[model samples]
Target: MTNTENQARPIFPFTAIIGQEEMKLALILNVIDPKIGGVMIMGDRGTGKSTTIRAIADLLPEIEVVADDLFNSHVSDYDLMSDFVKNQINRGKELLTKWIKVPMVDLPLGATEDRLCGTIDIEKALSEGVKTFEPGLLAKANRGILYVDEVNLLDDHLVDILLDSSASGWNTVEREGISIRHPSRFVLVGSGNPEEGELRPQLLDRFGMHAEIRTVKEPSLRVRIVEQRSDFDKNPEACIDKFREQQIKLKENILLAQSKLPNVIIDYSLRVKISEICSILNVDGLRGDIVTNRAAKAFAAYQGREEVTLNDIKTIITLCLRHRLRKDPLDTIDSGSKVDRVVGEVIGDV
Candidate 1:
């Protein structure tokens, strides 16, 4: 984000959000291990998709960015952040330190491609007779979260660009006489109403996991969620204080999960079993199998388990690989239900 947008921030706190435990867990899991890929939340409207992202604003670690660098590139990590920042001395813009938080930037549905990738500042270059590049949303999203609302409705061209940049971990532009390459290594979080539109398969595969969120059906749970949200909205400080302990515990859990993830063991037999599951489902890519195993291992670690087991694999199969599966054209399909049934027959019985 630019120096201007940094001045503006989200109003809600992540811990105070309510009624979407699965969605919340999925995001937290991604944060603990970004290798889990990224999260895609498709559900009904008003289910706190946007709110969940906004609330996470205060939950991330504060980072040090280049003073005026567009991508919020880390100052100390400049050796690896981007070529644009590396060539600052030749460009005559002195690199200064400007520490900023891990941002959660929202890309609106109506935003154009130029605005996202950035366009040449004709006024400055022509009138002043000098070259300058204007920063866009991607620049601000580096090393943070890039949130796209109603992502299914995004234009096809934009979707292609997003897929490429997200997969490559950088964005390169050669237009308007400005050839620039910069880092764009943010976790892509997208929420949309699947009924309204469908996400392109190419882009869908880019996301690591798919989380389906629905409003709470239980009256008591729904009421509690509303009451808590209302109470927090009315008195922010008091509500934050009450939930401070939960937040602290949650952060600690995340740190523990990160340390334990690499240590979680997945044996050859289990790897073969995971591959069998993917093969049975006719999933097309190796990425699905890889992500499923990683997520299962991560889940085991999160629950403080030392060894990977059948239950962990079963629990995370749907979250990890369902979105990447090939859809059955004739059958009225429930991907999650199918994943569960396969686990029950194959892994559960074992």
Candidate 2:
């Protein structure tokens, strides 16, 4: 497709989305601080999981990247640059740059290891003595968002590969004796229906946060959602125009949060209580505590605050700890509620 045709494709505006506030908050926090890892969204089918994810990509401001780079390598940030780009920079080459919309790559369930991780042409290497490496989805996903729909249905091994690359911020493909490594940093967002299946806890815990959404129950709200969707389908341009102001404001807010995140501070006592809840819940590892702190700070930054408050932690604590709790097949309590209960006992009522 031509660039114009691609750009012309209409998307539902993020601000126009009516419900699923938890999912939206999780996505925005991850965007503000990707080091919180990524978010895993579990919800009923048709809960706007995919729609909200796509809208987030559209809502984000354009990013500057190296022109003609396969990995969308940032022109200036060394950590976001690919190996090839870094080499060119090290050699003092003048790099051309351009601004483009943030990339959002969908990981297909049927993708093979090589297709996800790129490949090397060993034949060319042995005969012509040149390593010809083909870039894959991970390459394309660098410095953007990698979304996996129906993530629970994805093969466990493939999920492992994804989690590894996301955690390490790099992807390496090896063929024979040739190995090629490139930056694969991106926020990994996965959504799946709980009725279909659940991700293995080990893999799921690697996700920074988890947001559970249900289909809207209020009749009036449901009607509003339906009407908004219908309007978008009939006249996308008009629907987009309707939300233009809100969209711009939200985009600016997200950009401002990203810039202010480093300055947002969570108090020592708040950190202690965060871990205390995790410990009481018998959560595995330190991920729960660490993510909760990071998410709280991100939320504070999003709210244009420099100091993280108890309300900030309370707002995001459940999302940070819900999935990390050990599952008891016989326990009937909702994980989110259980988290709230523990938070209440440890931190006192918010």
Per-model clash counts, in order, read 3, 0
TM-score each candidate: 0.88, 0.94
Model 2 alpha-carbon miss at residue 294, Å? 0.4
User: Per-residue CA lDDT of candidate 1, range 1-350, in tens?
Assistant: 68967775435667777667768877887777766777889898988898887767567657778776667776557533667677775578767887676777888888888778877777998999877777678877777788988898888788777666666777877776789888877777888987776776666877888889876789998898889888877876788788788777877787788889888998889899899888887888798888888888888888987688888887778887777764543322245977877767767674
| Model 2 regions lying over 4 Å from their true place | 1-7, 121-130, 328-333
RMSD of each: 3.8, 2.2
Supply the global lDDT for candidate 2: 0.90
Candidate 2, 1-350: lDDT as tens digits: 78878785788999999978899999999999988999999988888899999999989988899997888998888888888899999999999999988889999989998889988766888899888887889999888899999998999999999999998998988876778888899999999988887887888889999998998999999999999999999999999999999999999999999999988888899999998999999998898989999999999999999999999999999999888875653332255988999889987866
User: Candidate 2 at 142: error in angstroms?
Assistant: 0.5
| Model 1 segments more than 4 A misplaced | 1-10, 76-80, 87-96, 259-264, 304-307, 326-335
lDDT of 2 at 148: 97
